[model samples]
Target chain A: MTVAVADVPAVPPDLLTVAHLSMRFGGLLAVDDLSFVARAGQITALIGPNGAGKTTVFNCITGFYRPTAGHIALERGDRSFDLDQLSGHRIARDAGVARTFQNIRLFPRMTVLENLLVAQHAKLMRASAFSLAGLLGLKGFREAEARAMSLAEDWLTRLGLVHVADRECGTLAYGIQRKIEIARAMCTEPCLLCLDEPAAGLNPRETAELSRLITSIRGEFGIGVLLIEHDMGLVMGISDRIVVLDHGACIAEGKPAEIRNNPAVIRAYLGEEDPRAGPGSTDAPGAGDGA
Target chain B: MALARAAPTVSSGVLRAAFGEALVAAGIAFMLALPLAGLRLPINPMDSVIFRPWWVVVAVATVFLGRLGLALWRARVAPSRRNGVPLLDRALAYILPWRRGIFVAFVLLVAILPLMPFADRRVIDLGAVVLIYVMLGWGLNIVVGLAGLLDLGYVAFYAVGAYSYTLLIIHLDLNFWAALPLAGAFAALFGVLLGFPVLRLRGDYLAIVTLGFGEMIRIILINWSSLTGGSEGITSIPTPTLFGLTFTAVPAPGETAFHQFFGIPFAGVHRIIFLYYLILALALLTHVFSMRIRRLPVGRAWEALREDEIAARALGLNPVMVKLSAFGLGAMFAGFAGAFFATRQGFINPSSFTFIESAIILAIVVLGGMGSQMGVILAALLLVLLPEVARDFAEFRMLLFGGAMVAVMVWRPRGLLAHREPTATLGDLSRGREPAP
Candidate 1:
């Protein structure tokens, strides 16, 4: 149902281009005319204060919500996905856009391996011929199943979850569950991966492990990563680029060094007036329209 | 050391609590059973009433001793067993090692049961009834256990299958073998039709809608007198033959019945044994087919959907296709069972496919443990055969059944076989391989 809505061909510059993206819940403009680009093979951090529209932007891009108005285009290797036009599941299935929840959402009763195998459901189902061929243990179905298992095992090992592969997911520690969620999303082999607050409840050690995992995921996998993180330390440590948002509109977008020094970005986090608060601010052009 | 120190006070407190509980239990037992146990019912033929006061003391003493023994056992074994597996669980694990062997042996026995010295006609017939329910349970297991869809109207599919066979074989003059698949197809069609509207509903709402659908089909079958024969139902339906040869008392013109064709004597046991084996084969087929499906991708998808629908959707699974496949496949099995039921009885009616049948099938699935094929068989035998054995108690059979069900639930809330394994296991990763179990 979601795939059918992707009728228009759309290709913007870069892996993902959010052009004039706007979202509204009733009167609240959760994301208002926000625009940014995330290049392929880079970790891009979406940072803002507590109520910033970071998660909302992720939700709209993933097609969980019908944006009030916007153009969110994702360009895969040979194809481009008009994310705004695609619905929720098609965005993940067809557009190669995968996302993790703010809270971990692993299939708890299923084993760690099963959780990852389930991520490759579409491909296996296609090869299985509605499971009749699989039931008979046909060659094609067996090969497909073997491929799915290896992919799952690969992701599990990368996330350091292979030891607990046979254990049900719910029994695992919270930090491990988070990694499994990321690994499960990775099993989909998406070009663009969106992670929501992956380090929310981790300790300093686990947070460091998460930062290393995220860095390796980008480096080894060569995929664009859009991360929503509250930990400034992990964000500044791993991000190649940072986009700052306040309320619903973008205040600044640039390299981590430039973003870290920007007066408006500081003011958004500190929530105070400074000598550089006005139009004199580098990226903050009075919040309305810098355009 | 701290645990050891705390153990003394904890043990003393436990003992005091047990003493207090036993005293209260004894008091309650005495008051409750005083009149019931101590007094004779209908009095005697000579007197208005006869009081046996020592009966009350016996009741009180039994409760007192039983409670005290239970308390002491809980204090002693429960504490030590806390850090260790319980004996019941250990026994289950002991059985687990031989589970596959046990299952094979059980199936072998079932196969040769009709030939067994002790196997009477009534016993074989009862076994057939159990097998029918076993088939039904396996079918519903796909929808409810694997797909995680709460479908309470699975019996509707059974009803559809039976009616389809009745209409096709008798009315349309189709062969029983040909009508079998046709019956299953009709049931699958109904499954898909019912599955479409309730695709978006979850949990209790899905259950209620399916329940309504079941009732709706039964009501229609009742009111459509011309088509279904109403409450009177269709009769004299042709039974399934062994390759067009009937197992009959009187041979049809130009037709050589089963016994004559085989050159065996025309004994009723021949028909009964044939029917038993027919159902046994069907049940075994359903079991083997479902277990294989469980290892396949679509089966894994059903499990994923069951665990969490949002997660399944996130995996890019087409929920509609997965859910419908479960419904269609499950209903097909139900259809097969229903056709067999019709053939076995040579009569059909709406009353035979009631909500009670659906409930019993579901109870087998749940009590057997959701998704476990072997659990379904065990549950079917327990639910079906236990009541028959308890028939000596007559009206109390149901009460005994209810008590046993309650006891099993209290013992294992997650069902009998709660252990789960991953759907797929790798031989080895490309690198950094862990040894396979």
Candidate 2:
């Protein structure tokens, strides 16, 4: 499961490559000619203003909506998946690309642990032998269930959700639920975790914690992290690279510093003649281009 | 004590509001009472035409006083409970912690009910009827509660089972034991058939489709006389034996009777009791099977799908397969119950598999607090026995049943036993704590 840097290219290798991906819905071009590479063991942030097709790009990458044209490929140590050719569930299951929704889609009625366990469904479902083994509590089923619980517990304890693990997921605070949603996605053991607006409704303190979480997700899990966030502080603080989009097209892609200085990103985000806001050099001072 | 600590101004406000509320309520009551009280519908309408304005005033006053009392009680009670959750909800929550114990005790009662001296022929028959509904409830619970599919045509599978068993026994000369599983399989096949086309539909649309499916089955059974016996229905289906031994006063030549083999005198009650136990066992099996799977991966996936299908897919659970399995398994259980029904009655008709039958079975699942086995049993007994107990007023029993259902819904909007026991837990958080440095 470990990917050694010495065994790969100097650029750290693009674990997920969205090459010329385009998506259209009826009369609307949701995403157009988007191309970006998220390296393994790195944090990549996709940032833009509203209706800039940030979510549409995530949807195309995660296979929720098939792109009108082009390829989204995920390359591991030796394995690869043409994500554009896969279905939504298969992208998560077979391609090992787990995603969380913009609105934090957790099974509200289920317990926190159950939500996490559900993410390990494919593993358990296989071990369940179509529920025959699981129903009878066979050795394999028990082991699979134990493994799922431990994984769930691991995420729960890490996210400070252990205290409310047995409580229904809907009752948790929004920030806590967001963390649970991330943890649930992690439980799937995804190779490239695509998070949609992880810091949407979070306050300053929670957003700070989310930055640390995203950094550690790359550091500890050694997996590529694609974060869709409006919180510039979160994005600029932790992101190794940033992809800027405007009107479904990629405007820029570079390190956080370069992305901040990119004129196209500033113009696209702050509007042409705002004059009041530029790409603030410091991290997330106020409503500016990166904000 | 907390209420006492509140300011005195609030009490004055409550007093004024109560009077205003009571006056409004009295006005509504007067309006409602006018038509009913002002008109007479006796056999001799001319002679019994009596309009007493004094009586109307007295009725309105009584209603007003009752409303005042209710308002006072509401003001006195805790606001927490007043927000739709009554003290009854807390009591129900308390009971939930000991649900396993309650379930065991309830099962024991059902197990021993047939052996009691008061278990007369009527009691045994009623027990069988309740058990049949209990089985159907558990079957439908899988489709409706766990999978969140509204299957209004569940009785189609029931009809499939009954007719399958009847036709098998008559044409193929198959025994009840041999035909039972076949009947279930046939129904399951039909379930898959229904599932494939309707997998794309959800909620109300799925319900409407299933309702049509049920009616279609009934109509087919009525028309296909050669195969299903049509409106005349199938009759004289052989009674299920105790391992090939019939419960008869005189055994068929070279065959042993149930009582004779047991060294007891042959009594028809033995057969009734046997049938009751049989259906009870089937119902218990259905409950156990459903319970066993709830903790498994498929079961978790089902509950997850019920909560949010998109999230379920994000986790890589196949919606179509999950839905199809639910439909097939749910229908299989219904088929088993239907087979048991045919055996118990020794006859069945298209009338038995009507839309009303589907409605009653569905009502059992909902009334039993969907997915709760104990709730289903309790609901089945109440629903099936209430009508029998109220046979003295046969026509009014349905009205009474509807009123009872509405009252329960108002009391427990989530169903009586809706406290969901989580399948996944990590023991106590305190117990799992590691020492902090």
Cα error of candidate 2 at position B93, Å:
3.1
True-structure lDDT of candidate 1:
0.85
Q: lDDT by residue for model 2 over B1-437, one digit each (tens)?
A: 35446644247778789999999999997996666565555667467666778767886999899998888777776564656656777788778778889888978988999888898998989888888998999999999888899999999999999889888999999998999999999999999999999988998999999999999989999998988888989898888888989977887899899988889887889999989988988988998899887777887888888899888888888898889999999999989998998988889999888899898888888887877777787788888888887778664576678778998888777776776778867773336566322
Please state every model's RMSD to the true fold in angstroms: 6.6, 4.6
All models, DockQ values? 0.46, 0.60
Please state the CAPRI-style docking class of candidate 1. acceptable
Chain B TM (all candidates): 0.88, 0.86
Q: For model 1, what fraction of the real interface contacts is kept? A: 0.69
What digit string (tens of lDDT, one per residue) describes model 1 on residues A29-127?
899899999978788899888778999999898887878987999989889889999867788889888889997888898888888888887788788
Rate residue B11 of model 1 by lDDT.
63
Worst 10 residues of 2 chain B by lDDT: B428-437
